[model samples]
Target: MSDTAARIADFIEPLRVAPGSKVRLGRDFDPRYRAGLKKREGVELLRTGVALLAEYQERLAAQDTYGVLLCLQALDAGGKDGTIRHVMSGVNPQGVKVSSFKVPSTEELDHDYLWRYARRLPSRGEIAIFNRSHYEEVLVVRVHPENLVRQKLPERARGKDVWERRYREINDWERYLTDNGFKVVKVFLNLSKEEQRVRFLKRIDLPEKNWKFSAADVRERRHWDAYQRAFSEMLSATSTPWAPWYVVPADRKWFARICTAAILAHTLMDIDPRYPEVSEEARNDLLAARQELEEEAPSGAAADPYAARTAEAKDEHGAGHGRPARKKHGRG
Candidate 1:
């Protein structure tokens, strides 16, 4: 790896939650961790990372053999939207799909918890970004058991151990995806309670951001300790070798976005997707097409005006021998 890349790798290493490791969120992960990067430096790194990410995305689409799923989970105002906007800004819109999961629709409630997410999985050669994802089943629902009642589970499925079962199920599902060509990348934007409070106040104070602050957000904030416990357990239980969770420091938006971009770029680097190689027949076909285009160029007008009148010819009767007159548009 280049020095820059090595530095990025080191920067994000601490964010990953190792599989089978116990997690005490406030004790272990620091929400303000910046990995020694200043604001301007982090922004510069993020810009570079986004460019590299775009190149990898183009190659990934051309390769057309693997897909990537980025699952982003966070509490209210944890900066999931900004992180997605910045981290994936440079990628092709055609190759990346961002799915932000809000409250479940009536139709969504009829299916399994993972069903909605399953239906939106990325096709080969594409990247899917899940803004909240199925992890909410454990995080939010676990925090508020009343929310679980809406799922309407059968008598057999209901138990104190249901969360544990869901964890195992999620781990297995992610493993299954990895067993195939799809890779699952999970990230949790770790925002401190105080930082979240500050952000919530900012939203309330700013007219432009007022719409982002909901009364429910403060209501949820009242359950901060409960949510933190849920997040801690969720991170500890669901993080696996196939789909480990990266707890990004979300207090500093610049550093968080930079770390998020670095982690994604590193994964693409590890995947090492490349543009597809052309076969001999395809190469010949490309060359033939190139030659045909060259023959119709303005440079060839001197040799055969009729054949090369492709640039800007205005003919009253049009070209003879079934050739059409050229009408140039802006760039053409």
Candidate 2:
């Protein structure tokens, strides 16, 4: 396979492994898969991708009929934050939303496991990214079965068939979303346990990243083997043709981000959203309004103070500095 194709294949190959499977993709799949691109023409493609996805954001936002759902699943310290930040940098925040799932709250526990997730689903003409999502209930919760009891699934629904049944439900749920105009692109950030240990240690060693470490993280690492088994089983069961998984290698953060952006760009283009054309009457009305605004708009500086402040802010910060400042290093 070509390098990019091989990268993609390596990511998805692990999903085919059954639950409790002790397989490692980094070794099973060639680590040198992307080495050939190091001094080659990948830069031009990456630049082209930036402009292409920007245009896609415009077209996608204009369609107003469908939305893009980005599902990012990863172990702790696997670069989920970095992937989202770099890969989605080109997209307009007005048309994009992100939700980070945390431990269930009292209110969240009262509803079905998927209830909290459904509330965060994307609206038409927007993109929604889940840093970690409903898949956690299957992966993490499976390893810690007590979580299943906490979610309050009836004892009957929590039968021996629970895991398989959850898979079918998730597949049906995704198909229903697709049929109703949602395009789902799921990415699993696959980092080796050894790599993760290095990252976790970095978090503790780096002053800025120290807040990201917690006692719970250390505790979770203790259950690493169980989590892997759960993840393998979850992927094998839930990966469908409609909502397939892309297992991104997290050993290299930049490469993983590039792969994610490529996946998003391909999915958006496949949907073929386009900007709506103005009708003749609407065009004339716009022209007339433009003329009137030009006549009435105060000459040089008085167009609007709010507009002036916005312009000054844009010039001060780089373009697309809409949100408040964020810490440069952290984990969520």
Candidate 3:
């Protein structure tokens, strides 16, 4: 492996919550962990990661055998948007899609919670990023059970065990996706309460950022402990082998993005996608077409625009040393 790749793997290992490992967010992880990287160094690592991600994405698309689903979960101002913007900046837009989930619409509310997220699952050979994923059922809904009554779920499905049941359901769903060729990678941007407070203050202090500040966001702070417990439990229950959770420290935005890109690059590396190889028949067909195209070039190189382009192409092919390009002139 390249030194950079080896370093990235080492960097990400500490962030993964192994399957069946109990999770205590505050006790086990530091929100401000940057692994001793300065912002400039982290940016350089992120640049390497983004370039690797783009190269792998092209291979993944051409291979068309696997897809990737990246889930980002975070509290208010935890840098989810910035992570997506920077980590995904170099990928082809057509091969990558971002789906942001917020308050459900009336139509969305009418179906099972997973229904909305299921509709956005990545097709084979594409990447789909979920800004906030189906885990919201366990995080937000676990914290505020009042939203349950709004759902008006069937009597048997609405009980104290609902959270545990939903966890099982989500794990099963992810496992199914993995077995079928979609890799699910989940990241929780772990931000400290103090850092969150500072971000809120900054939002209010800057005129350009004022629109991002909402009074309700402050009100939500009152339930911070509840959300913490909810997040901890959700991570514990869902960090399975099929879909592991990486608790990225969001105190440093650049480091979090670096970690996310590293994780994505690793996932693509595991998939090892490659362009389809041509068959001997296809190779001969290609050679036949090349001959036809070469023959189309008129003897005089400057007459027709089409012929001029053909002559230029033939000249490029003709100028190289070594074995001659074949001509099937006498063949049918």
Higher-lDDT candidate of 1 and 2: 1
| Model 2 lDDT tens row, 8-70 | 445435433333334444444332234345523545555656666788888988979889899
Question: In order, what lDDT does every prediction score?
Answer: 0.88, 0.77, 0.92
Candidate 3 lDDT tens digits, 183-232:
99999999999999999999999999999899999999899999999989
Candidate 2 Cα outliers beyond 4 Å, as residue runs: 1-35, 39-47, 287-332
The local distance difference test score of model 2 is: 0.77
In order of TM-score, best first, we have: 1, 3, 2
Off by over 4 Å in 1: 1-5, 300-332
TM-score of 2: 0.78
TM-score of each: 0.88, 0.78, 0.88
Ranking by lDDT: 3, 1, 2
RMSD of each: 9.4, 11.6, 6.6
Distance (Å) between predicted and true CA of 189, model 1? 0.5
